[model samples]
Target: MLSTFILSQTKFDDVNELVKAGEFTKASKLIDEKVKTMNLLHEEIFQLQFEKERLERIRKDFNKTADDILKYARKYYPNATESDLRKWEDDGSLEYKIIDGKKWYFARAASNLFRINKEAKKQKELIDGFKKDPLDVFLESYTPKVLDESANAQEKLVKPVTFRLNYTVTVEPNAVPNGEVIRCWLPFPREGHERQQNIKLLGINSDEYVIASNDNLQRTIYFEKVAQKDQPTVFNIVLEVTNYSEVNFIEPTQIKPYNKNSGLYKTFTSERAPHIVFTDKIKNLSKEIVGEEKNPYLIAKKIFTWISTNIPWAGAREYSTIENISEYCLTRKHGDCGIKTLLFMTLCRYNGIPAKWQSGWMLHPGEVNLHDWCEIYLEGYGWVPVDQSFGMVDSEKEDEKYFFLGSIDPYHLIINDDYSTPIFPAKIFPRSETVDFQRGELEWRGGNLYFDKWDYHMEVEYIEPK
Candidate 1:
């Protein structure tokens, strides 16, 4: 039947004769079947055509140039191997780019790969229990302890603390078009239980000018160009806070840790945390540890351990704001030198230990920078300096990593006192004051807060610790 069907379907004369002799109708039926087969093939061709267009669109969307991919990969991986990058491309994990005759991978893809690597390392450390190096361990383990409030009860008994204030002003030549005569007013500390009233002009040099004031009023040393200059010239002015009386030891003024309530105090305290961390450790270790047998030296050792174990030293995002330290502790779980010191101070204050603030910028022949630590009042020993941020002693025994609390390096320039005092003579424009001592002003040329504004800066030096 199949042979007869084939013959009838053929278009040759012999085949036609066969079909006519046997069954032309069967041959016609076979021809109809072949036509149906052709129609089915046409449908397949249409489906393939649609698929081709769809694939083309997908290729366009996924396509990336070599240069683009390479640039992104370099930025993201920074140290990734070329082979690995190629494998990533093969795996369809990254896109490529070509720009300026260069090849690159997508930055996002590279970053993803790098993240995976870091996470792996972190996990390995977590699992291995390989003791982190002293420094690494110290950075991870430091926390500021709470101070004992009872110890500071004597703060009220001590004489009002006093400090000498000193400053130098630089007058620029040609600062004004003409030789302008300038009058300067110096800021005095503010009013409270303390009194700062006496004023004195020590001396003046091309770069050296000095003024002295009694009483704790926040004052601004004003300079008026009495004579205008054609060329910019510089002059130095100095002022001294020769008298800081300690009427009594004040308790932690704010409820927050390390007196975090005041914005200015918070900034100064946090800015100086690293140094405080070390000092706090020493203070803690030197204590009796509550239940342990009392050994002053042993206690000091424990304090050092506690400091190294608790506070993690890291740079702060912004040290200028008052709440910088507290906020940092809350989020990053770490802080710079200043904040650590404040934490230590707070802890000591809470535990009946007397701790106070101390800070200054390090000044070399050509550079000056800010630094802070603390001081504790000890019986008979008086106030001794403590720089916990520098770390513990016998530093060589534990490596540089463990040397942050209890001591300080020599590269510091001390500037301000432990507590914030207002600028003296009351700024021509009244300004808000803070414990960490930041001074800002708003003025009205007239008798109102809405006067035209002016600004000033004060730089202090410790010629000799009084």
Candidate 2:
């Protein structure tokens, strides 16, 4: 009887019946119960089997994409030594790419690849299934609740607008001087009009002084002057707009003012404490250098020094989230153009120097994009341009330290203000709190447009006095 029970539990019903034949009807009922139980067990086994198969298929697809990326990387970078590949893998510099059915990278494994692949595949299946379904489906998506969505309530809205920025700087005689340059890089516009071209050059102001426009990166204008003696000079620049299209104007625009209470402001204030380079260092270094609270030139020099020495410029252009530059300066100790400019602005504000934000596109022939920097307000000078990102100060150069401050190369054009209300107004869609300083976008109706969708052009004219 014990053996029969054991056999019955082991799924051997025939053996269980042979040991308990005298209770034939009871044995028959027991077999019926066992059969029902087996059916449930079979269903569970089939489900597990199906799951294993599905997972295996997903794994195979992911491995295939990874392999393809590897093969492409090897083919393209044949000269790359094995050590280079290993180092990239170790440092997590490599990633896999499968964008829009086109592969983007051929590199080592990326930790996110597995998850991305799974999610992408699932989305693809969902989209495909929706297409096949005869029933209509409603897809609900969400957008931010910001202003700017009501700009286009009517047709014949206002045309797009453009602005021109000019700056002048005066420096001490025999001060090592370097030329100033401008950079205009904007986010590529989605629609409207596109950038047509850029024109800039140089001329002779006098036998001792020459005016040259540094027009590389297309949109920046650098006004460079090399002075042999400590003397005063003036720089004139004009940015002209052509072929621009009009768009509706939106309001409630509040420019972000230079905030002394900001963390960035505190950092610069602490760094520029009494007896430091600007105050005591200047006193110790030269009798000619003097500290005056109202001296814009001296304040400008100090701001330049703090930016060039303290901030390390790097490219975090493709980041999905906006980083807190002040916090970054406090922590990682590095940043890109935006971060550096903020730091510069903060330092100036802490010391009662007035500074603001300016940004636009640096137009290349085939490419025009957005860039950012700052401007400082001086008592005698109004608002003077400062590009801390390019290390326009003398301290930024390794061999030639402290040469470029108060001067710039003539190669740039300004297209937009740093913190103005948007041209088209805000949309309900979520927009980046930190504007890219180049192009902004909005979508409501089925249509799309870019900076090129409108008729817009920029011209730079360099004037040198005879």
Candidate 3:
């Protein structure tokens, strides 16, 4: 009788049991209703909702078993083998879960592998006919002649461009309780950087918006709107910013080493958990990459070249959920811009070079998209930009080849000074994105809303040249 009582489980405990047994949908629905009844803190409620919702979504379209995934991979490419599938999944190039005692892979992951692997096999060259693989499509058309001919060192400063931006954030039709306040945060530019400045909020659709202090690393403009029963809650803002192109002429041999005791040196070299860290493998790899190089510039150059040549760009899993982003990239040999940036920073830091994270929008004439890059600190130069993703292994022109190593064009809409740092007015809930905050973060009293439950859109226009 005592054993029977011990074995008995509550309704909430049953949900946990179901989750452990890989019955995510059942578990999700079970605890979802009890969410309202549970006397939990706001953050606790938000995390519960977020986790359950994510589990259900992952189980929804990603129901294919191992055999099913293998079959799908073979369907697209006859050459695919069980070994290849296992390898990709382990490397995190493909993602999955264990459901009902079976290894299930996301349908999207299978499709990505099928499409990318198939095309990758056929390409000796990509984008166009070229002698070597061009670093980037934009780089192909760029030439040194574009620089201001009359500009000398004193006049080499970048002119700012007036960026007119229209940004929007919305929650799903019925994501939260009816009439509950949906708090939204939109990314806002800060006013500290020498290269990027003059941030002005020209207008906003929501009259009640709060701009965070200029010193906030991850600055945002907060807004609150009451969710309607069947309608989506939307927040919109319009702003203009001035951003200057960043460039630094380097004399590698004459450069001085940083004072090891300085705060800037100490802060950037120290490890930040989850993303930037020096694990055994990372430290070993850093040593291997650096070899005998004592010069920071040369060490940076070596690491940049190696990563660019090795890691081909691919769609990546969400950064918030990943444990160690730099290790993930280094081991996987494939990563998007942010992943590559983190890897570069980690390797640099491991070798006594200081580095930090930066992210914003890459405003090209054709498209505006989220992008990440890093800042490396040198003694005399202060902080210089380094974008391993914008590598120049293929470019023959010296100017075009080394352009992004320590400089950036004026097309950047700089957003976050540092990644993963908190924003103003402090969130009471676990953030939707725990790593890199770009699109925005949203939450209410009941729970935090994930990306699947919301949508965001951005538009950029050139108002004037500064």
Could you estimate the TM-score for every candidate?
Answer: 0.38, 0.36, 0.82
Against the reference, the lDDT scores of all candidates come to 0.38, 0.37, 0.73
Candidate 3, which segments miss by more than 4 Å at Cα? 1-93, 106-119, 123-135, 143-154, 464-466
lDDT of 2: 0.37
Q: What is candidate 2's CA lDDT for residue 360?
A: 61
Return the candidate ranking by TM-score, descending.
3, 1, 2
lDDT of 3 by residue, 351-379 (tens): 88899988888776665788888889888
Model 2 agreement with the true structure over 134-242: per-residue lDDT tens digits: 1101100000000122234442212222323232233334233333221112222221123222322223232332222222121222333444444543333433332
Looking at model 3, which ten-residue stretch has the lowest summed lDDT?
1-10
Question: Candidate 3, TM-score vs. the true structure?
Answer: 0.82
Model 3: residue 263 alpha-carbon error in angstroms: 1.1
Candidate 1 runs further than 4 Å off: 1-235, 238-320, 324-331, 364-367, 397-413, 428-466
lDDT of 1 by residue, 136-231 (tens): 343333211101121244331221122333444333443333644443443333222122222344534434332324343333343343335544
